[model samples]
Target chain A: MASGGSGWRTLPPGGIIVEPGSSLRYKTGTWRVMRPIINQDKCVRCRMCWVYCPDAAIIETDEEYVDSKGRRWNRTYKVNYDYCKGCGICAEECPVNAIEMVPEVK
Target chain B: MMGSQPERFKSKFRGILDIPREERFVSGHRLCAGCPVGTVMRMLTKVAGKDSIIVNGTGCLEVSSTPYPYTSWMNPWIHVAFENTGAVASGVEAALKVLKAKGVLGKDVKVVAVAGDGGTFDIGLQSLSGMLERGHKVMYVLYDNEAYMNTGIQRSGATPWGAWTTTTPVGKKWKGEWRWKKDIMGIVLAHRVPYAATASPSHPMDMIRKFEKALYYTREGPTFVHVLIPCTTGWRFDPALSIKVARLAVETGIWVLYEVEKGKFRVTHKVRKRKPVREYLKLQGRFRHLTDDDIEYIQKIVDEEVDRINKMAGEEVIGPVEA
Candidate 1:
């Protein structure tokens, strides 16, 4: 949260951004396994959503969920599509059974 | 201004060899082909140069490089068990200090300890904590390859989330290594040592500079260098792509290049535009089970952590810092 040069360094706008064009040039390696799906309505406030994330992929908000933002409600949990591994733990760990596993499309 | 052109060129385009060549890890020992640690060890010793002593924890590097009579280390190096190198290095420093006090040993020799993630994060943490608290005049380098690669690929505390190690298999019931890597750097940085930097074999020259900073920054205080060394044997990657894989780590922001000196943080590699964590994870055999949504989830975390670090550096807040 600390801004200004004295405290911490910020990534310049272009800093550390991966170019989309470069993605396919190298081998995509292995990831063709499992996918994760989430149901927002059944989700509770339990932070279990944030704890088990290995890739640190879960996003939770403290604000109340509002429909006006067009984004999922605040305090509502959502997966950051950019980094989720779809391991299903988030769905599985949801105490309310709000998440489900779908077959990963090839 | 006229003289500035040649001077600027000399400084700007400096090659790596200008770094130094005092080898601590010698050649002709056993290490896996294309082991990332080998490259780190070579570059590290080059920076530490000629006058140094190393305390090696028992791991692939220690096991492979120092098999009995044959030693790959040219400098004065000792292999204590997996959990005691920090303590051992502390003793080395204390002994040198006592000897110096008694006018027995010269003050030229530097001391450093090399450890794996298993050694640093899980087993040797107590010793490391003690050394940092005591502030021994030594350097400790943790070659992080995620899991415990030396021990047939078991999961360590440093293994990333969603990674499939032998212990943390991905199955119908299980996803992968369940927990996140413990932030050892944050813990070490809290000690407020004279220097702490994360380097990668991908940036050999930058790595050399970090090592030099550690070796010479103080003859009487502790310093820690965490290097991201990719392991092919455990991660199941082509051995030849070790350097490339290491590069991907930085490029993708899964692993960052930065330093904290006296609590001032500076991220060296300007990622300019960040790479997705999936890009880094997808290259290795370990994360093969990850789905697109999974990749997105991981990307979110990587971005959050990066933002957290950058925020500490006072950079713009990007994503998921609350997590």
Candidate 2:
């Protein structure tokens, strides 16, 4: 609301509330809270964000976070939107940057 | 002492807010009584929490944390030498990748690298640049007390123009450092890392929220957070005035908090009205030697920097729509 630019079109209330992947828009970049989006294809399941997120935002089972081979991953990670503060930690700490912050529709 | 009364405690608190019961940094470690880095670290850990991999450079935080098999860190932490924490965090990310692949790590683990002004603006600049260039998913926090406080308060790149340091002292013939505070945040932004920000202990919530955003940039690759951690020892300010001095830094526009993403710039916190930089400088003993003319010059620099950032933030830049 604080002059966050005219081009920022508000999304319909019920539009899918996804994380604002790496592309966050706010006056301070600090003010921008992002949601996490896990790309299964690229995810290595490091779970760094799970351990690092100030708010416990990541969710994923160790079993589910496996590659093509039937091998368990080093860590399983996913974003829990309910508790996730939209802190980009999960996205920032992802070994592969697999987790991204996608914009959430208000 | 910050007594038990809540309102009185909060109002009297300096630099930033502290959420009791949340001991991110934990207790029982030693830092200098008036160390600026310690205060800033408290704020960062409070916001970053236990679910973070805190990579610290061999500075005050690292020294205090790793006192021969003891650590104050409540979070999963590591300490590499002075010039490579940024690089080491990159490797930590790589390891987490393998561990995550093996189903042994959590998605919530955030990676953060904390360094002093010397490490960030001078010695570690190259490694930080490399991390940014490669787009590593880490939040590199520069706790700037201006000079190299960890190493006897020598001058570093972050030392302000005409400020005194053991290395850059004022004399009858020469002023202090005699150069500008390197625009480290500005340099970080030029790399086009997904997120780059400047914060101060003055606004605890703001600083916390910034780290929140930094944590969320998982896919964006590389984020830099520069926090203005005022020094009581190095800057020669009263320990009690630390927070007040930090507030003055921003209020006077001597230290601006703004961010740039995809080349667009904007002011994160604006002081509707400007205050004289003199008021801010007058509080610090470091700048006590500054003549009115020197203060005027510094004031002009602050004003110009503010104006430039405001202009950039005003520009319109389109971003991806919410999925």
Candidate 3:
């Protein structure tokens, strides 16, 4: 149960989950010692990082991108730090080497 | 024709970049950092969408995704016992059918039952068989992490030959699991199921397409999709290498990706020149202890299976095995 909530007494009959996606309240951001940062200039918007992320932490942003070759990408990827455990699968799987795993300063 | 209405697009995956962005299997609860089961569930729910009820069997997917007071599932979900997931999913599918006929329920509700290899290949085989034989409209997905991971990597029937687990420890006299991995797809196919496919999270586009077909198409008996979920902690690999290892399994001949529909087998991801199984085996600590002879034995078994599957397809879907 989350903070300031009644314990077992207020639970649904037989403890059926009434609220969907209740796990959002429990943040897993602190679990990582390293964090992945995407290089905007280098990202080609291939979405390799987004598609390969096991945690679903890679978020597609409506940001504009233009590579050195004059190719344009309307959307790019960013990491959702709240749920990212820094597995670095995105970095490892990126075809362009756009993602880099940096030490979590905190 | 100018005034005509345009054709509506279904929820089909157009390409790798195109996918449903709905967060059905939301982040949280707790799964291992690089567990492909997470990716599997995410992609599955995305394909199945919101008008679905998920029946999860007891295993790591259940233990990690649905701890007390929270759940990673946004869709209607029920936690079934290890041995009765098929029964529950069948019941749910039946109930939905009756309710819809009686006008008690509205809209189409899809039923998807998910379980790890332990629950499906071993403990819950009977109920699963019953579900298939009865022809329920439930979609069954086997997330094969290759062992009972959450309870500490005990060997399951799905554990590969010569692979280490707590129960199948490497020793002087005893090797890893001696028995070959259970042929679940064959068993599923024997039920005369309409659509069944083997997939891996490494190939997300292909995986999602199979999930889509299993969830939406295939008009008859229960659909089964067996997916290999490479584990991080259990496999003892760098968490980031999860997808890479899964891809390697496909590139090598150890795990073949194919779909069998209406008794017809078709290879989905065909490797042109198959790599040696050692390239895949050497990465995971589970297969670290296999001797050269043992590795050769495994390779021989893979080559034989590939040839057999190739013969079944009547073409070289997978390339000839490499030495």
Kindly report which residue stretches of model 3 are placed more than 4 angstroms away from their true locations once superposed: A1-6, A66-71, B1-11
Write down the lDDT of every candidate, Cα atoms only: 0.71, 0.66, 0.87
Query: Over the stretch B122-234, how does candidate 1's per-residue lDDT look in tens digits?
Result: 99999999998888889999888888887789999999889899999999988998788899998997777878999987776677777777775555378999998788778
lDDT of 1: 0.71
Off by over 4 Å in 1: A1-106, B1-14, B21-24, B316-323
Arranged by TM-score, best first: 3, 1, 2
Winner by TM-score: 3
Residues B57-128, candidate 3, lDDT per residue (tens digit)? 999989888888898899999986999999999999999989999999989889999998999999999999
- Each model's RMSD to truth, in Å? 20.7, 21.7, 4.4
Q: Candidate 1: deviation at residue B235, Å?
A: 0.8
What is the DockQ for all candidates, taken in turn?
0.01, 0.01, 0.74
Best DockQ goes to which candidate?
Answer: 3
DockQ value of candidate 1: 0.01
Candidate 2 stretches greater than 4 Å from native = A1-106, B1-20, B315-323
Give the TM-score of chain B in candidate 2.
0.87
